[model samples]
Target chain A: MKGLTLSQRVAAKTILVIIFLFKLRNRATRKKIAFGIARIIFALSPKTRKRSINNLRIAMPDQKSDDRIRYLAVTAYQYIVFGVLENFWFEDIEYTFEMDAATKALITSGGPLSIATMHLSCYEAVPFALQKLTGRVTTLSRVPKFAAGLHSVYAKNGVCCVDKSQAGAFLALAGKMGSNGVVCLHSDHFGSDTELDFFQLQTGAPAGPAMLSAYAKTPLLIAYAVLQKDNTYIIHIETVSEFPIGQSPKAFQFAMQAIYRQFESIILQYPEQWCWFYKRWR
Target chain B: MEYNQQLKNVLSEILNIDTSNFMHSTKLLGELSELDSMSIVLLLIEIEKRFSLEIDIADLEAKHFETFGNLASFIKNPLTV
Candidate 1:
């Protein structure tokens, strides 16, 4: 086995201690620490500040003011920090949803279900909450190279993460649908195999979920967890039927677009909560 | 009766541009000027909605989007033929 160098060992020990300290802190303390980190990031990173402003400009073309943009950028940074902290504190937190009977019926039905989720406030918390509320839950996510420990935490919580980079991951995911598992996936990010036309721009977005659903002859449900002013999340669940069973690929892409349009509407409503740090249009 | 022309008409309407100005030879990105990344995505959505087709990511190629005529032809009778 390869041994760690003195610096590497020290860094590893420091990170371990930080993680332990973070876990030991109360929720309020975590929020304060996250907010402090956000403020520091805002003060230090000029590029991120500029990018946030540019993102808000594109998202809201009509709203033009330096002060407003700056405020939005700061708020977005705070949200990003809070989101990260939420991931750590998610296991202890609880959420309440006011889903309609129709939505509940679709969720309770023992069949393959696909959930379309965007990067919203405490996005990870939604699935964690769902696993607590509904036992069957899985999420399509790219495995982070540095976050092997985090993956184990997610696994412990019953949230299955599918590495998007794997060749046959989509196929395997499609096969899993037969067991009536709830697969939650983000359709916003750009992917090499994806066709363009997202967020009023030409960029690749993976069509795997839509294609998998079409192939499996399962239902695709659109759901998003948005944070309200009072810091509670409202999970909006809606079923879009534009993409019928056995429809052609183009029809499925169109259906995906309709779903994306709904996501855009949600992002517009809460621009600060959206993950603007990502190169979304690119 | 060719599906290529019909597809071109649909593309023109969605983009709010004149079909008469578009040619089979005109490229989508640089040549059309109006066909940006967002437009391309919107066009794909419109195509899927109108024609009931789903496009795979691996199937996309830059050359496929090079010309209006090329896109029209591809959509009219995809390479699957």
Candidate 2:
């Protein structure tokens, strides 16, 4: 922290203040405060509120009521804030993982696997829980500072992170996956010229998981952790690559489309838990 | 420009736009509102189908999609780029 820039030091201090405040409350009170803060942010920030509204409109055009869509947008904002607040509480809480027997076997086998996940509720917990099942889990993340905070709590919890901004980062991730490591990728964002159909609209979807699985010659899996009413998280994991992994770009497109279809289904099921403020379709 | 008619056809279909006025010098990335992230991806897929070449994500750049001519050249010979 001595050599850090002023902005970084301020950011770190803000995070510390959040954690200290979070530490003052029990789980139930913390959740209530988090939800209240989210509501305030949603009400205050017109940009996020509008973006969420527009995203939901594009994602579900036939919903037929603006009020319903607006409610979902506000709840989505709350969920995102709640997710951030819960990051401070991950170490003390126990998350339940729900998957089929085959899925469990695939994760427990500790073989090479690539997981594609999104910004769903408590999405960060998927990798944390996976590290418990397998001995190691690696992830490509963009934000190093945020990850550093989580690493302090889950210190050496077998989660290896590589900054995605560096050149040849994908090669490094592929090398890790080549050695039978589980690499978790946040794949719900847009990438140039990597198109896939999501919610019947065309948008750029990351082809990393599909391409990495093919390169690594391992099964590609999709997982998401959603929050329940009882202040607990339930992680759902599934395998998407049922047939032989194809190396062609066409194969990558097909695999990604299938993955987004699954993502859309999950979002539709838990609309409030997903991050709709993101310009996903744009 | 004549060699790019097939390219224009594929682009129009994938992007759901009328290619009546799109010249080889037409700006794509910024000028066209239809060429957002999703259409850009479908544009690559359609280019792959029309040209029988597979374009990797690494081969993609803003310059390659700046204009219709640039896009056509990339589709014609992606590996050399």
Candidate 3:
């Protein structure tokens, strides 16, 4: 707090207040609150709103109508905000797991693996639920000073939370995979490790999941959560590449492209759930 | 020294850095500006392709990539380390 700027302090305090208020309400009421506040935040932040629309138009050139794009942007922001707020009070959030028979057997076997998750609705639901099953779930999060509550929530869920800002965070994640631990990383965001074709546009994506899977000699799975009308979440986990793959730029790009393909399908299925504000197509 | 030279060649190719001075004891993560997050992954890719070795990716950590020698050692035999 001492090094924070005036606006940063205000933002942090506002988040704390939102977290506190969210704790006082049920899931249904909280979703409604989050949606309303999300709208207000969207309206107030011109830069964010503009970035969201710009990204949408770039990624979704087929959407000709401005109104439809704006609507999609707002709803996506609402879902992202709702998901972030849900992390603070995850103890009460309801979610169900969806994985195939082979994945279940593999997970139940408690073998080391890498999970690539997106920033969809309640994205952390995958790791949270996996911890309940295998008790070996590990997640890497950029936990700043203000997001300590998020760190605590993961701790409370019996998930090992590693700080991404730390020097050896990637090491910790890989080490977790080395020791039969399930490592889940959010891979939807921008990165320079691997070039990918996302939303029909060329973009750079993190190669951590694919690299870990191939280099560690483990399986790779892509998971996402869809928000339900009942305020519950349905988390879907699908294997991207389960078998061994060659370690090379070509192999990493192939694996990452496979992931981007799945992401495109999920985003198309739930247009209002994926974040559109990311500077995805640079 | 041969393995060290091979590792240096991989690093030079992936990172586009002059590795003439690179040695087994050379520091990587903090010392080299070119060995960023992306380079780290690219390094592994090239290491596997160059050596025809399937590295145990799960066994990788920061220390494994901290020094040129560390990576060479791990790639030589991860199970022993």
* Chain A TM-score values for every predicted structure, listed in order: 0.88, 0.94, 0.93
lDDT of 3 by residue, A162-264 (tens): 8877665677776787788988899999888878888778888988888778767788888888889888888888887777545676887898888888888
Best by DockQ: 3
List where candidate 3 sits over 4 angstroms from the true fold. A1-14, B1-7, B23-25, B41-60, B68-81
Give per-residue lDDT, candidate 1, residue B30. 53
Better of 1 and 2 by lDDT: 2
Rank ordering of all candidates by DockQ, starting from the highest? 3, 2, 1
Task: Report clash pairs, candidate 2.
Answer: none
Indicate the TM-score of model 1. 0.71
Model 2, chain B only, scores a TM-score of 0.83
Q: Chain B of model 1: TM-score?
A: 0.75
Per-residue lDDT over A1-282 for candidate 1, one digit per residue giving the tens place of the 0 to 100 score: 026566655665665566678778876676678778888888798888777777777777888688887877887788877876577556666567766777777777766777777777677776676676678777866644444455665787887776655534554455466556777777777665446566567666766557656655667777767766666677777776523334455755776787778878878888778777666666
Given candidate 2, what's the lDDT at residue A281? 72
In model 1, how large is the Cα lDDT of residue A217? 62
| Candidate 2 local lDDT, residue B16 | 86
User: Model 2 segments beyond 4 Å from truth?
Assistant: A144-156, A242-244, B1-81
lDDT of 2 by residue, A1-282 (tens): 566677877887788788898889898888788889889988998998889998898889899998999999988888888786676677766678888888888888867888899899777788878888886788877765633565554444567877666544565676677567888988888775368788778777788887777655678889999988887888889989744367666887888888898988999999999999987777
Give the TM-score ranking, best first: 3, 2, 1
State the fraction of real interface contacts model 3 keeps: 0.60
lDDT of 1 at B77: 64
